[model samples]
Target chain A: PGLQMSQQQINPTRILVLLNMVTKDDLTDSDEYADILDDIREECRKYGNVESLQIPRPLPDLDVPGVGKVFVEFSSVDSAMTAAKAIGGRTFAGRVTISSYLDESKYFAGQFQ
Target chain B: EPQEGKRRKRSRFGEENIAERNLIGAQTVLPSNMTPLQQQCYILHLRIEDANMRLRTGRFGYSDDPSKRSPSPEPVYNGEGKRLNTREYRYRKKYEDDRHEAIQEMIKLNPNYHVPPDYRPPVQKLED
Candidate 1:
């Protein structure tokens, strides 16, 4: 599993997963959530065409998988690769964001956790 | 039995420590064939890394003791005078605002480019 993670870090995919970029409270407020979504989209568009973006929201009284993580699917692997390089380790919302390429099959299956 | 226990402890901590060290050292090397725009983006990424490290190392007025420094912009207090947020939260918010300013600078660099209609600029300031 560790080997696979390192391998994925070196490779590029169409889906990029960013961590530690947001907090649960930020998502709970509708206005704040909208602002965050807009900020992310605008920043990401600079790299390439974003096919879709997802940020799993926290559910009250329940632990949700992939909550607080931002997932971006680019239209091409090259775009995703560029975004991963540009965004990984960048500070967002005062947190050091960690970006990595996720397997397309796993992303499609919605296994964000 | 003592030796067995020692072996178990060593195996448990040793593997995890090595894995973590590798993960931290696993930054991808920049490819040589990148375009000028890509190079600029990479430089920004490196700058971000540098800033994060500086923060972690307590370079930007971060202290081990919470009371040593006054919270920037002042934190919100409830009616009873209890602070609504932690000191860490206040620092994080300030750091976030600083990063947004950096992004705004990056946007200004591309004067001819048109932002999307729905594009929202980063917040000028955040009030807790």
Candidate 2:
């Protein structure tokens, strides 16, 4: 708790949040979800090396807006930026998709909690 | 035989690579910075891209364009499973239409239409 503010602040280099796409039905079937992940990875891999892909699948009964969201972690910041620019506002699963960078701290915190 | 199959696959990918390159070459530079006019153009570009992708994939049969889905007067139903087409229905329809128009008018009157979210990137330690 010292007053020295010269600490090297870490920033997320390669994580994106995809919003307003993927419905409850999309994640129910293994084959369907695999196809979707393939489609997303194929589209995103055009930019750079995709390290990992995460899509939260909430229970079908749960009426949550954040359920069908996707998170893509690339190997580098440049690839993430390129993919975000290309994918943002484009139609995905018939919805106008939006994307932004995911906060590393919050993501890890939520995962642990 | 396996080598032949691999060569054929490579040739197919070569053709796809050429097409992808052409697409990249044809794409115009979209401004990264957001301005009012730029945002409008960006939306239009997204629409065009959506249409193009649909057309390319042969999945362009049905579309839900916003212009076709404008809010209209809601139809009221009678108890006997019939459409109420009386003078009162006409009046109510007009009133409902006027109310919808007022809502739309009020919505458009807002000058600050677009509000970009405050961006805060998640910080984490760099893994060695």
Candidate 3:
């Protein structure tokens, strides 16, 4: 009974991973990337206080996997959860956006810390 | 007396089955039975869970399947079909090299490096 109760009580996470938000070409120019980030951040801010935001810029050398994903950390888990639902299947940067909660440990990993 | 005992046994079994049914009904709702809007929300919940599972398991760099998008121009190569030794190439190479070193340094300051794993390398076709 206690174990079941604990499982049911799991809380939402405070980070969101926005996939395919921008492409490599979109990130090639620093100024353009910054502008894109600003646009994303502005849209994300509508859902909650964004604690941090990250978008990877893979160098031309390495075939860095998962390049166009965006991570947004919010002030509260509830807000992040709400934002993930609200953003699902919505169009962003001319592509359908697919977002999910970043696992707390993964959010703290070498990326998006 | 034997007949009475069998009836009592059947009644006890029936009560147990009803109790079990109630227990099941008391548990969380099932997604399959949800209304259309609720089902949609449930699916979104499952997708978020799936995404989180991939992230938490150190599967970031390897697992993402990106959607189709226009290919970006490839890095400029030389006329000899080799990566150019042009100033632009050197500059980009230097920047790329330093970027990782800077990331390491930043990690020392704030242990969580901001290298989110959502970058999908552009696919290249083999020329005939």
Candidate 4:
């Protein structure tokens, strides 16, 4: 019944999270702006130090108001991968649309699509 | 006699097709693997065309104001009572202007901008 349980077993590795979030409709106001950012940050922070973060502006022609579409960047690759793994196919603020990025050109090209 | 009438109808339809050739010249960007720059440029081009068409021919529109009837069959450029016409016109006008500027910017993006517009398919020569 004896098992070698050490600190690594207890401690958790931090993760980097990057996403291209597309909302169900356009963003009308700043209702979920801070909370949405914070949620993503908190989820990814568990993996490691959040070195950098970014959310790129929406496409010029698209008429997205509050949260139309965005590209979220994270510091650590592992953290980013972890958050991507966790949030794929999850609902954000009631809308069932959230996913992660693989950081590949073709994949991102698809996003341009 | 019936055949002659049918032939006349077909020729009239042909003329209609020729008239719509420019619109047929419009390029369709498949939602496939597109680079961001390419996508942006293509979208800009289409959006500009749409804006100009709305301004010139007055088709395909939106409304910023809620009071007046929007997207009506009768495009009323009326003012004094409703603000909807004014706001949408400005929005449409701004986009039209921006898109025009974008075309100039496009020339900078692609030094090959002087090339013929990608509108029609190349003609095929008949070999004897």
* Model 2: share of true interface contacts reproduced: 0.00
- Write model 3 residue lDDT over B63-88, tens digit each, in one string: 12222222334667778787656433
Chain A TM-score, each candidate: 0.87, 0.75, 0.80, 0.48
**Model 3 segments more than 4 A misplaced:** A1-11, A63-66, A111-113, B1-128
lDDT of 4 by residue, B12-112 (tens): 00112111234323322112233556544554444445445445555423323433222333444446555454555755555556456656666667667
lDDT, model 1, position B19 = 16
Summarize candidate 4's per-residue lDDT along A40-68 as a digit string, tens digits: 56655665566544443354577433234
CA lDDT of every candidate:
0.59, 0.50, 0.50, 0.39
Worst 10 residues of 4 chain B by lDDT: B10-19
Task: Provide all candidates' interface root-mean-square deviations.
Answer: 13.9, 14.4, 19.8, 23.5
Give the CAPRI class of candidate 3: incorrect
Looking at candidate 2 chain B, the ten consecutive residues that score lowest on lDDT are B9-18
Could you say which candidate leads in DockQ? 2
Off by over 4 Å in 1: A1-9, B1-58, B61-128
Q: Comparing candidate 3 with candidate 4, which one achieves the higher DockQ?
A: 3
Quality of model 1 by C-alpha lDDT: 0.59
Error of 3 at A111 (Å): 4.3
TM-score of each: 0.50, 0.42, 0.42, 0.32
> What's the distance in Å from true for residue B20, model 3?
39
lDDT over C-alpha atoms for residue A28 of model 2: 81
Q: Tell me, by TM-score, which candidate is best.
A: 1
